[model samples]
Target: MSALILTSVLGVVLLYLGLSGNKSILAPTAIVGLVAAGVMSWTGWNPGLMEFPTMLKFDQMSTLFNCAMIAVTVLLFLFGIDYYRRMEENVAEHYALMVFSLTGALILTSYTNLLMLFLGIEILSIPLYILAGGKKRSYRSSEASFKYFLLGSFATAFFLMGIALIYGVTASFDLAVIGQKVQAAPNNVLFLLGAFFVSIALSFKVGAVPFHFWSPDVYEGAPTLVTAFMATVVKTAAFAGFYRFLQMTAMPPALSDTLLVITILTLFLGNVVAMRQSQFKRLMAYSSIAHTGFLLMAVLANSAMSWSTLFYYTFTYALATVGLFIVLTLAKRAANGNEAIVIFRGLFRANPWLALVTMLLLLSLAGIPLTAGFVAKYQVFMLAIGAGFIKTAVFAVFMALVGIYYYVLVIREAFTPAEETPVLVVSPINWLVVSACGVAVVAFALWPVLVG
Candidate 1:
């Protein structure tokens, strides 16, 4: 809870710094504040005490998620030092808005009440709507921002209505009360409907199939740094919140069957559509959806290891994603703003180390052996099978195989030769971030204990 206060204060501090117009200090300041918040989160864990009369709670699981997200946000801020250096306007707001969004993320990991859940999703999303349009000069950015706002508002309405239905039936918004009331969930049609509505809203936030139309467009249109935040921090928080929701509710037959269909569609569609993308950012957007399919499986499994596996999986994904986007920023500059996968051509010749690191990061995302992604997927499949969903697990494995091909395409481009290669300059800070992520993925893969 104190960590939440600190980050909220940190956001206001960043806005004040923005007023000074000295953009030079924004990233560094945000980084320091986030590191402190992470430490506070780690040290504040107490499972028995429900803070604020069950509005919030700090447990071992939430603490791990809080620290993991803070670590990822710190990496993004470090990357921002270089990503935002060339831009002259609203640089501080970019940093501040992200910090504020992260504050909402912290709230999500700790919330124990439906009201807090609604508040957390709103606080997290409102800033992103503005940040998606940060590139005011780009028509695509404006379109992305407008589309996200409209769709997000629509989802929020469904979410509020679901909460209202739940409150009407149970006469309370506390998760514990809902848990007691939902034990006979299979017989309650209204509760099942409410759960279904909530599921759709959370699925939209996580970019699952039938609700993922906003991702590719927004990712392509928004700046790379903002896209990285959307893919990592936003996703982790949503899943954590959803995990809590699942933990507290008894799954009725109707809701469970509905979710199984969504999972299969997400896995099938997210992988199949990604193979057709030519642009790097759009490819990442779809690829992200593919990962969501895997994670949705884990959430459905809901085994004892779900939280630990989620922390490891999402944290490693964040590492690879941040590094790849940094590489993209360099490659895009070299290509004169063209974001096609072909821009990666001759990357091996230009800088072998960057190319090699790029392969490792991509390999991790592809879930290749001895990489963090492999361990994450392996654990998810085990969970699914253990939960008696053998057929679903088999289909997921096939989808994961399909997912590997798109990543290989990017790797092929990076290693391919080009007639005239443009020089890809790497800033010192960017190089450090890329290398750190490259090392961390392999380290966590070899030593899975690095997470919990």
Candidate 2:
């Protein structure tokens, strides 16, 4: 626990350092700090506190999420190297904000109390609000920040009310104690309302349908790299907290049924809406929401393997999104920084390696076989079926097929030839980001994940 806290503090310190205009050291320092955190977590060294009065557990689950968060942060730092190269202004603040967000993410994964949970969410979100508006001169960026802040604050209020209600009933904010009360008598009306509110709060955080209104706008408005960070690292951390909440208190029968209905709706809506998107960034945002629905199904699986499934799915999904976003940034730069789907036309002819990398990433997102996305989706289906939710799993599989179609269209554009070819050159940093994601996705699919 001390080690984890140290890591979180160090990230905060790095952010302060970044604010001092030291662009050259920002990414490297963050990478090194994340690497250290990963190493400490891997060694299995930490205080065994039922942290925050038993609301959070610093056990295997928290450790797994910590490691994943650190890994993602490391990759983001690498991508940030080139992403921020030309932005001479606010360089320090940008890097610092990232570190602060990462610290919140770490806290989120280890939260033990409802108060801690809410704190973690705020810590994670406030920095992102600023990061979205990092481009001070861009109207779209400012719009994105404003939209995100308003929606995020609304969600946070809902979460706070839920926490208050839960505390009112149980006279405790500790998750374990709350779970005990729920299990003792599962039909309490106020408890059920609290649970529903909590679910809605987290669902919004992960961008589930009906509650996902801000994602596309924010993703489209923010810088490509910032969008990637929110989609991947911030999301994984949010889900970690959501997962803990579910595991601590199994939903009552009524709430469980409601979640089942909501999950199905989210999956359908996410896929259906993504099909009509023309902007690559917005498409990815909608697609990410769809992916979130798939993950929610895994969480609903309620099996021994749920944790491992969530961890692996998040890693692979993040791998694809992180890589795809990196490609989008570079491709956008090549096309005078446009975000249109057509910007990728003739990509294969212009740069085969980059195009192929993009193809693999899209393929993974679409859950095509031989890629991590396929394996991740397969695990989700198996978990759902194993839990006797065959109908829900079947519908999810159908949606998965639909998902493949849109992603393939993106690949088709990448392979299409342009009437007049233009030269494309990519930074080594972007190339490294693409290559790392490609390798990690394939590697995880081939190996048995450590989480079991």
Candidate 3:
């Protein structure tokens, strides 16, 4: 609770700093506050306590996810220092919006009530709608923001309707009470419908196939930094909430079958479509959707180790994504913001170290052996097979192979010689971030227990 309050206050403080014309210290201030909030979250670790009339639960799982979110946000803010260097106006608001969005993420990790869940989703999403349009002068940005708002609103309606149906049946919005009701009447039609609705809403939130049509355009149109935030922190929060809800409910077999179908479709569509993408951001958008499929598989397995597996997978994935997007930003600038896959050609010749780090990040995403991505993917597959989803696991493996083809395609471009020298503007901080993420991916792979 203190951590939540602290993060909310930090957002307000950042807003005040923006209003006060002290823009220089805004990033530093936000960073310090996030660190403090992270520490506060640890202090509550394993407390097994509930706050606000049982609306939020402070447990080891929540604490771990909160800390991971904070860690990723810190890295992003560090990158933002360079990414936002030339933007003279509204810098502080950008930092504040992220902090506000993060406060919602913290809530998502801990929420124990349906009301809190809805609030958390809103808090996490509203800011993103504005941030998506941060590049206000761009038509694509405006279109992205509007499309997101419309689709997100529809999803939220489904979520609320599901909650209402569950509340009608359970006579409470509390997860524990709802769980008791669900267990008591597992075969209730309204209950199954409610769960199905909730699942569809979350599927949309995580960009699963059939619900993922909005992601590529939005990712391509939004500012790169905002896209990174959506891909990492926002996705993490959505999955956390998703896993939490599923863990609470006694999932009906019908809902499980639905999830199975969605997972297969997501894996197939995300990987197969990414093969033909020429735009770099669009490719990554599809890549993000592909990863969502893997994460959903973990949820389907629903083992005792599910949370730990998810935490490790998301943490490592976020690290690689943040690094790759930073590289992409630099590459985009070098190519005059073209965002073409060909821009990466001759990256090795221009700067071998940067190219190498980028390669490691991409390889991790590709699930190459001896990297964090491989460990993450291997764990998911083992869990799926253990849960008796052998055929699904086999299909997922094929999709992963397709994923590798595209990732290696980009790697080949990076290693190949370019027709002309690409002018990349490398900031020291960005290089440090990319290097750190690359090393962390390798380090975690070698010592998976450390993350757990």
Candidate 4:
């Protein structure tokens, strides 16, 4: 908990530095702090309590997520180095805000109390509100900021209310206490209702369907780097929280059924909608939502290796997304910042390596065999089938097939030849960013111990 607090405070200080116009220092400073904090988190990671009075855990799961979040942010910071250098004005604040948001993410991953969960969500989200609109002068950016703030606050309210109700029934905010109370009276309606409300709050945070209205617009409007932060780090933390919430016995069979339905709806909505998207960012946003559904399926299936599955899924997904977003930023720069799929047309002719890397990412996302995605999806399917939800698993398989089409479309465009030479210029750092992700994706696919 102290580590979480220190990192967040460091982030806040950095944000202050950023807004004060120290643009060049923002990324480097943040990178160093995150790396140090990440190391501390890893070294201290074990089954133990920190700030026991406040109720937070620093277990293997938390450590893994902390490491993953740190790594993702490091890459984003590196990408931002080149991506934001062009837009010099808000550079400082942008990096600072990202760090602050990451602080919130760390808390969300390790939180053990309902109060801490609420605090973590607020900390994580409020900075994002500003980050989303960091463009300062763009109407769409401002609009995205306002929309996300309003909806995110509404979700937070639900979360707080649920926490209150759960505290009322369980007479404590600690998850441990709540678990005891829940098992003691498994049929308690108020506890169940609180759990349901809490589920709603978490669902919104992760951008699951029916609560995913903010995603496409936000992804389309917000700066690309901000979108990547929300997509990878924010989603991962929320799922970690969501998984923790469902671990209690109070998550009744009826609630489980409801979650299963949500899983299916999210999958269907995310995939079917993404198929029609022309914008690459929007396609990825919807693709993320669909992936949430797949992740939730693993959550509902509830196996011993659920944590491992989640770790692999989110880690690989984040890696692929960070790489893809970097490529998108470069491609958009080449096309005068156009995000359309057509921007990638004949990309291979202009830069075969960039195009190939992009194709590999899309293929990984599609769960093509021999990629990390294949293993991730396969694990979920096995979990569902093992849990005896054959029908749900089968439907998920069908949706997986449906998802393949859109990813293939992206890949097809990447390989398509352009009439003009593509002027794709990548900095050494961004090139390293792309190469690192590519390597990690395949490296994990073959070794799998990268996760272990």
Candidate 5:
């Protein structure tokens, strides 16, 4: 796709531009490039690479995902303008690495071959390992980078082994051929084992439970921007790949049972554990895991509306998450880098508009009515019920209700009084992102056409 080529090229351009020692131009340049990439994706002008039918095809889902990833990245780079202003070096590297990671993500959404999937996952991940450690001076950042690298490496091994096993069975790595083989031998133990192993690797990528231990530590330790990128764009791509892999190829009954267990455990652990977290980022981390359970449910439903439901859920969740992280950044600064939820104390008094926007974003995340999050969850529940997963759907509802308490805790803190409330200073760009996210959620919900 032209957008894919453009993003890959843009990352390199940023690197070369970084050499000129004029750091001021990086974010704007990157944002402009991202916008152009997004335009190319949306317009359906995927020139070049048409001959490689077995490799990639930018169909509706992939194109939609590509555009969505590009759009969120534009938002991140916009925030990067302020986030990196105080940094001395490597600002361009940050922008460039994110673009490169995005390049891999685009590939993941479109890849038709297992080899391409492996390539895409590596391309998407290698940059993140570095970005997590971008804050070189922080020990926690170094720890995050190292921990993520080690665990991710292990996951990759499992993924590759699974691919090999599947190849061994089918004598091909092409998804279409593999699909045919899977149906030909539905009860083939080796194929199911391969699928199960692959599922574990993907679950690790998306932060699903049992494979989710790394998310909170990583989210809390990595630079918030990188964490936001992981939580949003990386997630969107991973789930899309996951749904495409399982659904398009036809999920085996054995694999469905395994996912059923995973979804329940992910729901139980993610919500129950989040209540114990006092740190803001850690809470968001577990909140993201809880969301993983919901997204897993969407994937499991495997209905005609599954992908649409997944995209809507992830995209809206991304908006809320990005805005909340910006809010957290501003609050953290005001509190002299304290990451506790207490940093938000008196936010309503210190900056009423920012605080109000914070409340709205939290509400959306908590699945409150009239917000996009609520609609997203409702759609998932309906889809699940329609698919005859009523027991699982009901359990999910209870967990969702459990999840709301933590979000409300943050919202309450924002609205509460403090003797020494940190004086948050929101930059206009940050404020705009926060307010826009808040409005977009409500706007998306009130409009019946979009919701329907």
Candidate 6:
């Protein structure tokens, strides 16, 4: 509760700083507030407590995710110092909106009531709608915003309707109550339908297959920084909320079967579609979808250790993504904002260190051995196999190999000589951010205890 309040206050404080025209202090102030909030979250680590009559619950899982969110945001803000340096206006609003969105993410990590769940999704999404259009002058940005708004509204409606149906069946909005009711009436048709609706809504949120049409377009259109935020922080929050919901409910076999189908579709589609993409952002958008498939596998396994595995997977994926996007931003600039795979050509020749870091990040994303991504994928595979989903595990491994093909393609471009030298510009803070992410990825892979 204290951490939530602190993050909320931090957002307002950033808005005031923006209004006061003190732009320089916004990032630093937000960083300080986030760190403090992270520390406060740790205070509620063990013996998880429920607050607001069970609307919110803070457990070790929530604390870990909260801290990871804060850490990722801090890295983003540090990178923002350089990314937004040239922008003269609305800088503070950008920071504030992100902080506000972070507040929503924090809520998601802890929400125990369906009402709180709805509120968290809205709070998290509304800011992103604006942020997606931050590049106001660009038509692509406007299109991205409009599409996300429309589709997100539809998803929210589905989610709300699910809540209504669950209430109708169970006469309660509290997760614990719903869990008790579900356990008592496991075969209730209305309850199963409600769960199905909720699952669809969350599938949309996480950019899973069939519902992932919006992601590649929006990612390509939005500002790269905002896209990074959506891919990392927002996705993490959605998955955490999804996990919480599933953890509370007594998932019927029908629901599990439904998830299994979605998982298979998501894995195959995300990996195969990505192979043909020339745009780096779009490729990554698909890559994120592919990862969602793996995460869903963990959820499907529903082992006692699923939550821990999920956290580790998301944390490592976020680290690699943050670093890769930072490098992509630089590459995009070098290519005059082309956003093509070709932009990475001659990267190694231009900046060996940057290229090396990019390699490590991409390798991690490809699930190469001895990287955090490998450990994450390996754990998911083991869990799925242990859960008796051998066929699904094998299919996922094949899709992972397909994913590696594209990632390696990009790495090849980085090493290949260019027809002409692309003008690459590296900001100090950007370099620091990428370096930190790279180091963290390798370090955490070797020492998983750091995350635990």
* Counted clashes in each candidate structure: 0, 6, 0, 4, 0, 0
Off by over 4 Å in 6: 45-50, 449-452
By summed lDDT, the worst window of 10 consecutive residues in model 3 runs over 44-53
Please write out the lDDT profile of model 4 over residues 411-447, one tens digit for every residue.
8888878787669898999988998888888787877
Task: Give the per-residue lDDT of model 1 (tens digit) for 32-111.
Answer: 99999999899983344436957988888889999999999999999999889889988888888998899889888889
Give a tens-digit lDDT track for model 2, residues 269-369.
88988999899999999899999989999888766678888888998899889999888877787789788998889899988998998899898899988
Candidate 4: stretches off by over 4 Å: 19-21, 45-50, 449-452
Over 40-112, each residue of candidate 6 has an lDDT whose tens digit, in order, gives: 8877632245367588877789899999988899888888887888888999889989999999999898899
Q: Lowest summed-lDDT stretch of 10 residues in model 6?
A: 44-53
Global lDDT of each candidate: 0.90, 0.84, 0.91, 0.86, 0.91, 0.91
What's the CA RMSD for each of the models? Answer: 2.0, 2.1, 1.8, 2.1, 1.1, 2.0
Clashing pairs in 5: none
Pairs of residues clashing in candidate 4? 18-92, 346-416, 346-417, 346-418
Among all windows of ten consecutive residues in candidate 1, which has the lowest summed lDDT?
Answer: 45-54
- Native-referenced Cα lDDT, model 4: 0.86
CA shift at 70, candidate 1, in angstroms? 0.6
| Residue pairs with backbone atoms closer than 3 Å in model 2 (clashes) | 1-47, 15-96, 18-92, 55-112, 56-112, 332-337
Estimate candidate 1's alpha-carbon lDDT, on a 0 to 1 scale.
0.90
Best by TM-score: 5
